[model samples]
Target chain A: MGAILEIKHVSKFFGGLAANSDVSFELAEGMIMGLIGPNGAGKTTLFNCITGYYPPSRGEVIFKGRKMNGLEPNKVCKLGMARTWQKVRPLAKMSVLDNVMVGALCRTNSLKVARDIALEQLKVVRLDRKADFLAGGLPIGERKKLEVARVLATRPQLLLLDEVMGGLNPAESEEIIQLILDIKKHGITQMVIEHDMKAIMRISDRIVVLNSGEKLAEGSPEEIVANQAVVEAYLGSEH
Target chain B: MKTILNKLGNNRGFSPVAISLWIAALAGLALFPQFVDNPYALHVMILFFLSTIMGESWNILGGYTGQYSVGHAAYFGVGAYTTMMLMQYRQIPPWLGMWAGVAVVMVVALVIGSICFRLRGPYFVLASIAVAEIMRLCAVNLKDLTNGAEGILATEIPPFKIGATVVTDFLSKVPFYYIGLSFAVLTIVATMLVQHSKLGYYFQAIREDQDAAHALGISLSFHKNVALLLSAGFTSLAGSFYAIYVGFIDPPTVLALDISVQIVLICIIGGIGTIYGPVVGSLVLVPLSEALRSNLIAQGIFKLGLASEESGVGVFLKENLAHAHALIYGILVVVVILFMPDGVLGFARKLFTARNRGNA
Candidate 1:
């Protein structure tokens, strides 16, 4: 499959610290790429650099053959690339449907059209019953689903989800996993930063592992599981 | 009670009852001056409309967009000074000069938005206050242009004419009353349009979470500035109206920090981020302050036989309350903030919902 997004040696720095260094990956079209790492391994930082939340200190992010190095997050979104926050930031006072509608509004100017699109997205995430409820009142698992629904409404070609299944129970995580599979069925490329090994292995077509702000391994889930360096990185971090 | 009222108000499509009530209210306001010939009453109504215009204008930015600009008086002062100066010095009529005020304030709003929108939270608030303070100081120091501390006294207003037919002479409060009323209506309609448009949704998204809105392709600075331009334009119109109606324009009268706070207070006390919030705020504040200033509340207490005018409490109310309007206003604001943290409308809605739950 042809690549939809190419992260070429991207690095992010914070003063003297290198949060991400020489991190490179290629996400193929119509495939789910799982990004896994130990705690503080710069998974989110890499996502930020790719999505235009932060300008990479080195290298480039090429999405759909366009360099997205210095564009703002909004501009990047308009280019059909969108990312979800690790901590879901719902428009807390707005209705759940309205929060999704905000994302739909990215593509369509009409609120009526946006609302219909938002409703369809909410149905995909199975949050349509709570569509009228205030977003802040939703539980964390539902809020995460709402975040995915929101980004989905933007009708992005490539979706980056930042630990969307984090903190959810197994049942909730299962639902999200199913939702992610369903999204893939819609023919959209996805990059998921997930901590759950079993879930990631089940869903990801391929896996890339990072350690201490650099790529440790990149292969299929079985190959990644058997890689010595990937095993050692997790083991070393736990100790 | 408030829940039912909210249900009526929150109806997505127009209800017959709501539409008729609105029409009746507008008709009553239109015919009010003819029935009440008392100049003092008309003067109070004019002040009411002026406050409504100011409050509604501020609501566009501060309420809908969640950019709580404490520097709105900068636009107000600019509009008043612009119109008054042109009329007094260049013999330019205020009708033409008001548009000049709007144009100037648009530039001012853009400049201020560029600076202030860079900051967030308390820093944004502080930056806004600083910008307004600088404008006020410039108005004070620029003696040549602003006529110094003595202020501009507009002793004459050319009669409003349409195609050589004199519409109204500047001799009575009736003309000023009608002008203020129309401006107030204009602001209300403008606010309603913004609230229902895509602009309002984008603004509220920014207000709820800036980063989330940005991720959804909403340009933060661009949309915020659009809101501020609309806000400042209407605010300047109110300022121009005040200058023309009151026949005076001074730094304190037009550009004071208190004026900025009052504009915010009108929105906050009613409800922020709602179209009718500022209107409700003006209705509550204008007459409350007027009654307090005139000691009408104190006199009404005596007239109702609550106390004799000679009694200690009654005498104290009559003697002190007139001057204590500001203090009372402060206390009222504190009460609203403490008990009704979401402002009156939200608080009332919550109360009604809770009571309904109890009954259920």
Candidate 2:
């Protein structure tokens, strides 16, 4: 089959600066693609363009063979795609479990249905223990996990993880990598943005690199480490 | 279902406790006026029930969706003016005039809601205030249609005397009492129905987080307008009740800023969004207001020798505390907000939940 999601030559301009310039890629079914770059490589800008947070100044973002241009983030979500913010955005006063229940409301109007789904999703994210606790009391790692559980409760066909593991310890990072794989096992297509080269290499089936809002290279990790452009863009003179 | 419901706060559908309580309250209202036929007491009850209805209606949009609208008087004024004009000139019964009032308010609220739903948070609040002011001003300046500040008035048409327990004179306040009580109960039940229905959860979701709700495929504008229209329609009914209860209506001061703020204040005091918030709020605020008013003017510690009814120092307090009464209400609202943000009932619910959580 064709790719599950296709970003065809997308260029998102914020005034004169191209936050994402001519960024193009695709995620096939069952594929876990990694989008990585040095800080400010426009990796997130590309995700935003695809997810309809920012409509590309040039070119279309297609999901499951449908155009996603000029769509609001909510509409994009209804199309069975969901994303977490780079920063946590929990409803502060609500219980931790209720935060996840919000995603289920998208698909079901019944609080009972939403609650049941949110509960199971929380268990999957290992957040069931703290479900009754107010979300404000959660640590950053648990908060990130809560975000993932919230998306899972929405039953999204495509899941985008936006630096959810950014602040985790090494052990915490490995657990998240496994969680990503487990999520893929449930037949959801995945794209994760990460700065940790080791975690990205461990989970992603394919990798795309960006530099200064431009696509620098696209290859397997082994090939990417060998590429002169990738090394120069990220490693500089470290090696 | 119970497990999930507890996890997510109250459940939908008719909980047995709510149904039984409503039924019992209705029965009591049907008979209570028999014992107490006093007109002043009747007037107090009328205003109390009216505020309850308005609070309940506003809760549909404000409490459920977290859309804090301060200008609800726009809807109330439309209802009042619609009924007053139709009854005065067209000679329509308020029974029919009330529906006309309802339609006008709903259509206007829908249009405003559709446009205003786009603006989030503080912007939406500002837009709602602007719409309410514009509507009020239009009602004021349009002298040809609305009679400007010169309002409509009708002499009190007492209910034609009926059976023994209910006389046509003061004896028939019973029917009006029943009707007011019915509206109060109906508003509460209607709020409950929407709370448990599929739409209620959508409202809760939208309130909690709009973007997250939208991502789940919920239609933001559709549900909000539905809520706003429903809220407007019900509130206008209360306005119509106010006109008939008083036998007169005016544009400028009769249906003004104070009317709008009073409804919300009652909701806040009772606990906004919760089922009994309006009822609880009306129960507390209305009686307190009445107490303040009655006690300000007179100077005697009067006691009604009737059974358990202790007549208070109402007349003297009414004379002396008129200015202070308004200030007291304002101060009370501030205290409630600062000390009990969830509202009076909301705080109570928190206590209940905390205890339950601990026991678990």
Candidate 3:
């Protein structure tokens, strides 16, 4: 299939520090691209640049062949690219259904239609039962699920999940892996920033490794595991 | 009829009994002047309605959208001054001039929104206060336009007319009461519509988490502006009403920082983000403040034999308590914030659910 998103030499700077340095990758349609990096490797910053939360200091992010350089986050979302935060931000005082309905509202002005979309997504994430519960009261694992359901309600063509499995138990992480695979079955392209190596391997069609804000390697999961530089850069002296 | 009752009952705790009670209360309020001919009681009712309008207006932005604009006096003053000036100088009736006030407030709200909405949290609050203070200063200095600090005083309101028929002669408190009641109802209905709409969800989303709301494609600037416009418009209407009813408009009276604080207090004291919160707040604050200002509270204390009229405690309360309404307000706010951070409605809800659970 065709590439749905292309990141070309994207670099982001905060003062003199380079948060993302000349990172380049292409995400094909309907494929799950795993982004793995060590701590402080600028994975989240790159996601920020790609998702229009911040403008890249250099290079381009072309999504659906449109250059997304200085667009606001809301504009980027309306253009069908939605991302979840690493620190899952739920609308705490609102009900869980309302949280998802906010995302669903991005597509339709009708509260009834948004409710339907929200409920459907809630069911997808198995949060339908707790739809009326205050979002702040949810556990971290379920908050992550709510985040997924919310973005899914936006009907995004491309989803960028920043550490969706972070802070989750193995079972919870397994469920997210299954959810990501299921999303792929619907043909929505995804780029996932995940720390769980085995989980990423199982879900990712291809993996791109980042080391100190630069792409260390990009290949299939088997090829990535065998890459010596990636092994050294990521695993450090332990590998 | 049964299906309609069931529908209303099923939707968000609006039981048939509650709906009937609401209808009864509204009917009583509508017919109050007919039963009670006392001008002082009618005056108190008008003040209650005015306070309701102001509080409900502020609640739209501060409570639901979480913008917390402490500078709402800018809109209030603009509305009061606009209508008063138009009537006193240009010979326009207040009914028409109120629309002019709304238009001017919209422009002012947009300008304030552009400047203040760029800042978040406490900075936004500070910016709003600063902007309102600037507006107050302008009103004080601009002698040619706003009549400077002396302010605009109109002794007579032009009688409203449709063709040859005069609607009212502007001689009675009765007309003012009806006008205040209608404005109060309008604000409440507006808040209710906002609370139940997608617009409210967007506003609440922005309030809960601005970044998350942005990611959900809710434009922070756009939604915040919409909330501010709705809030400022209603507040302006209240200002116009107050200017007409009170027959005076001064910078200190209409545009001061305390005016903004009082508006916010009305919502916070009752509950923010709920339709009835401001109404409850006005219900408590208006009568309490009025009683304090009129020394009725001290009179009641002496009448109840809590203190002998000649006692030092009684003398001190009787003499000083009228001026101590502000102090009482301060203490009340502190108590509410300390014990009921979610405000009265939320606190009441917590108590109600806890009691129900205990019963179960």
Candidate 2 yields a Cα-based lDDT of: 0.81
**Comparison by lDDT, 2 against 3, better one:** 3
Candidate 3 local lDDT, A1-239, one digit each (tens): 88899999999999999988898989899899999989999999998998889999999999999999999999999999999999999999999999999999999999889999999999999999999999999999999999999999999999999999999998999899889999999989999999989989999999999888899899999999999998898667675
Instruction: List TM-scores for all candidates, in order.
Output: 0.96, 0.87, 0.98
Candidate maximizing DockQ: 3
The predictions' CA RMSDs to the true structure, in order, are: 3.1, 5.1, 1.4
- lDDT of the candidates, in the order given: 0.92, 0.81, 0.93
- Model 1 stretches astray by more than 4 angstroms: A237-239, B1-12, B304-308, B311-315, B355-360
Each model's backbone clash number = 0, 18, 0
Evaluation by lDDT, superior candidate among 1 and 2: 1
Note the DockQ of each predicted structure: 0.84, 0.49, 0.92
Find the 10 residues in a row with the least total lDDT in model 1 chain B: B5-14
lDDT of 3: 0.93
Candidate 3 lDDT for residue A204: 92
- Candidate No. with top lDDT: 3
The Cα error of candidate 2 at residue A1, in Å, is 4.0
True-vs-predicted CA distance for residue B178, candidate 1, Å:
1.7
True contacts kept of 1: 0.81
Candidate 1 CAPRI assessment class: high
Candidate 3's docking class is: high
Q: Pick the winner on DockQ between candidates 2 and 3.
A: 3
